[model samples]
Target: MSLFLGLDIGTSAVKAIIIDAEDREQASAVAPLSIDHPHPLWSEQHPDAWWAASAAVLDRLAADHPKLMSGVAALGLSGQMLGVALIDAAGRPIRPAPLWNDSRAGAECAELDVKVADFAGIAGARPMPGFSAPKILWLSRHEPEALKRTRCILLTKDYVRLCLTGEAISDRADSSATLLMDTQAGTWSPQLAEACGISTGLLPELVESGEVGGTLRPELARRFGLRSNLPIAGGAGDNMAGAIGAGVVRTGDAYISLGTSGVYFVANDRFVPARGQGMHTHRHAVPGLFGQHGCVLSAASALNWVAGILGVVSIERFLAEIEAADLPPADIPVFSPYLGGERTPHDDPLATATLSNLRGAAGPLHIGRGVIEGVAFAIADCHDALIAAGASIGTIALVGGGARSRFWGQLIATVIDRPLLLPPLALLGPALGAARLARQASGGGLSHEGDRHGMTMLEPRAGWRPGLEERRAIYRQHYAKLPV
Candidate 1:
């Protein structure tokens, strides 16, 4: 039984899973995480919280399935990307790490846009407040003292890796999106670093996503019910891991991750920087391949927020009833879905959410249905942006927590007017993908791209298109007057 553990340090939680040789999930656990918004546009989580959550998750997994965990051969990691977690020479986090959705670095992003020549061409991602470099730039000016104390910089998963291995390392696939790497060269770019008021020395050593990052520490190994020599694979960022998990390795293959944030990912054989469009052209976890992504700052998170506002306790039941009601287009209000601003296409950091066309009789169902359709429309916007950027679109795979809703998936497919592929383990694709990487790192493979044969497909219904199209126009109208 060659078992592997896959852990994802996501924005909302730390999820850990153990899988066997047949790609069967043997054990799993999750620990919830909360973000801090100290200021209007700030979003942060102490690096300690991630490590704490990770430890708790691992401890639970080990306790629940000690025998299964003891048989684990290796571990793989995956998580959110492109935010700075600064640690000092004393091996202490300087402050709470600014997260990927933090929009406080808007001014710094503009500075880099002007300072770094050919910003998009060099970094393969648009200069945005959500990226890592700008977050560092924001720190450099706002809190120079913190930068002075910083010895090493890490991304979300790498920070947790530092805790697990006592080594500072990162994967190329995750680092490529940091705006500090030369996308074409696949190496740290000193010029880009300098423009962001930092140097390559602050960054961690880069490794291939499937290579051994470091061995687990003796103490943590005992806690995990594993041997000290258990290797941790150089895991990928969520998008890359999600791609590999969904068997999106071949060129023109794509997946739509309806996770905390919405990501439209397309695999490519070569660098395809979609200049002018907000698509990210970066390295893939699969060696020697590139990927393009259209990221929506808020996807499922936006819907979750609206649900909370409506005082709905059971999200599944709320969505079920909304799906049952099948409200007409006129009853569903227009939703902007920009709770934390946006990234793809608009790149507006100040954009706010809006629910328009609300009637006096509008209740939770109307509001809930509106938000659902709104997210689908927002996804369509991502599809259009990627298509305009010349990314080849074929059948799309939908993978994430939001994909659990049949109505939501169908609605999104209808809005995009495309079919969707649903993998059996769609909800935790990144973790599963990380396990796949772990298998590769151990030189013990169990599956191939051809394994996608078991995936189920969701075809769009033409009946829902016309009404959704009319509402999407209203949604666009609201977005056009954004940055409010």
Candidate 2:
């Protein structure tokens, strides 16, 4: 049986998997990685580090499952998006990549918003500092030497693709996040590229998410003890790949991801710009499709923060305490959840997380439950906006680190007032999505059509609905009283 490789280049780590053409996992490996934050608003990782991690992961997989190596037929890659990985003429990294989480280009973003009024019309979304165009401008102005020496600009996955295939290429789904592509047309935007003072000559040729770019290079193949003929398929941004992995491929299909940050994504068949300024509309991995996603600065990260503050308690113990706590006080509390400001509803870094209506009786359990409920409510706000804008969201699929907790999933379902579908596999996340892409590229594999084999449904508890409603009402009353 032929096998496929799925490599996910994530912010914190790199995970690689070997799955048969049937989508059955044969071997898996993960390598721990870290990023460098040289400044308050900067996040970067050495481009070489990704290559190192990929090599480590592939070597370990081959070592663990020797039988699967020879059968590997194709490789697909998925990665954290919107990175600015500039490279020299020789294809060497010029500097550490500015990651998606780095927001230092805020001023540059404001400038683009002013200079490019048709930005939303062409791209389906507004430009943010977390995107690449602004980062490119930042490099040109702040690091002129590096910019002058640069001959290629790549995203996280694109860099990996280059190392494997010796070809610098990017997919539309990944390019869209860089704020440099014409999302509706699925092409590079000369207008935006010109405004950013970037030379289009250095950008990689764009392709679709599943298109074969090139065969793996000989040296890379030998290092991993694999064949150089294995096809390398175009991979997408982590969120798009995660969406595919979570089975949110159909129109109106939804999923809420809570990792370091949060995203609520709804797939749409046609490109549609959201009316609200808060939500982002971007192209989907499947060509000619788009999605409107809302961003929440903190999701499980806030919970993690609370846990650490209260002394590193296990998630099980935390939830048990929440379950034992007297039903959340009947009174509503307003929670901003802006431990680091917000992204969707309000794009303000100065916005602080404020929980109003907390009395002396409120303890850590109430706080924990409130934080989880607050995140769900925030997602609901996004869904409501999407619905108002004519996007139908029938149900939400939960995928991310946060979805692993049944208690949290239940709370989200109750608060959001929708059934939550959880894919059976969690470790697979984007890597599984990459495998699905790999299989699709190979002509035939397990289909993503079935409802039973890959999903677990979480419905709002019959008894919990009333309490959720009451809590929502209380939250609204308090939230309304706050200054806009």
Candidate 3:
């Protein structure tokens, strides 16, 4: 059977999924990786660790199914976005990659925002510390030696693609996150690059998502027990891949992703910068299209913080407790999910998470449930922005760790006033999406019909009030009063 490999490099782990030409899953493997935080708000990872994880997972898949490696038509890559992976002249990472969560470059992002205010018609988004440009500037100013020797700055997937194919290239979806690309033009912007202190030499060549890059090297293929000359497709951003996995490819399609960060993405037919409309714009995985995406920087990370603070005795026990809590009918405490900062609406890195009502009755369970609700509310805010910006959402596909909980999914439906669609294979979200893309790119006979056999629809229960209306008012007042 012909198979395609879809490797997703996330912040916590590297996942490899093997899918047949029909987009059916053959096998999957996951290998965990570690991130280093040398300082506060600084996340870095060794590129070697990623490579090792990828190889390990590939080996595991090959061992499980001997024929899984044969006739591998195409390979697709997906990864956590906004990380800056600098390589020297030999196409090797000089140091650990500074990750998307790194916030040391807040000032640089602020400077870039001011510099590009007038020319924002092309970039389609404001600069933020979580982007590649600020991260690059931080490295250049702090680590002058590394900056001087840097030959190219690659996003996470771009770096991985380089290991597979000798070519140094980046996809437009990931390139849009760099703040240096003119997203509308689908080309690198010299003006923005110069403002960010980045030269064209340090940038990787940009390519479309489905376009072919290069063939796999013989040595790497042999190492993984795969045949040489496998094709590499221009993969996509992690969110985009997740969206695809959730079957969000059509216009007006919506998907809510609760990975490390949370995003509410709506697909559009053409490039529309809802720039001043509060949502950020990025090149979609589907070529010649764009996405209106709203991000909450510390969505799942806020839950992680709660888990850490309350001992890790049993995650199941904690989840059960929160799941059984008495949910409010109309109004609830204002729960701000911004632990590190926020991305959408305000884009403030200094914003802090705050629970408006902590009185004598609140406990860890309340806080936990509130965190989920808070993230949902943040997503609801984004939904409102998309609506105001003329995006008529048709469906809501919820995929992420939070989707595993019935309470959270239902609450999202009520809060956003849309039914939440949870496919049975939600856990395999991004991997399945990348697998589908890989199959299509390789001329695989994957059925594109809307089977949705594994999908579950979560409708709002009766008497589920629109808590978002009150929450929206409170959020606006709170944000207006924020001391930025």
RMSD (Cα, Å) for all candidates, in order, is: 1.3, 2.6, 2.5
Worst 10 residues of 2 by lDDT: 444-453
Better structure of 2 and 3 per TM-score: 3
Q: Write the per-residue lDDT of candidate 2 for residues 136-163, one digit (tens) a residue.
A: 8888889989988988899998898888
Candidates in order have lDDT scores of 0.88, 0.78, 0.77
lDDT of 2: 0.78
Q: What is the Å distance of residue 240 in model 3 from its true position?
A: 1.4
lDDT tens string, model 1, 165-194? Answer: 999999999999998999878799999999
Candidate 1 vs candidate 2: the lDDT winner is 1
Each candidate's number of clashing pairs is 0, 0, 1
Clashing pairs in 3: 424-454
Runs with alpha carbons beyond 4 Å of true place in candidate 3? 276-278, 312-317, 327-334, 445-447, 451-454, 466-484
lDDT leader: 1
TM-score of 2: 0.92
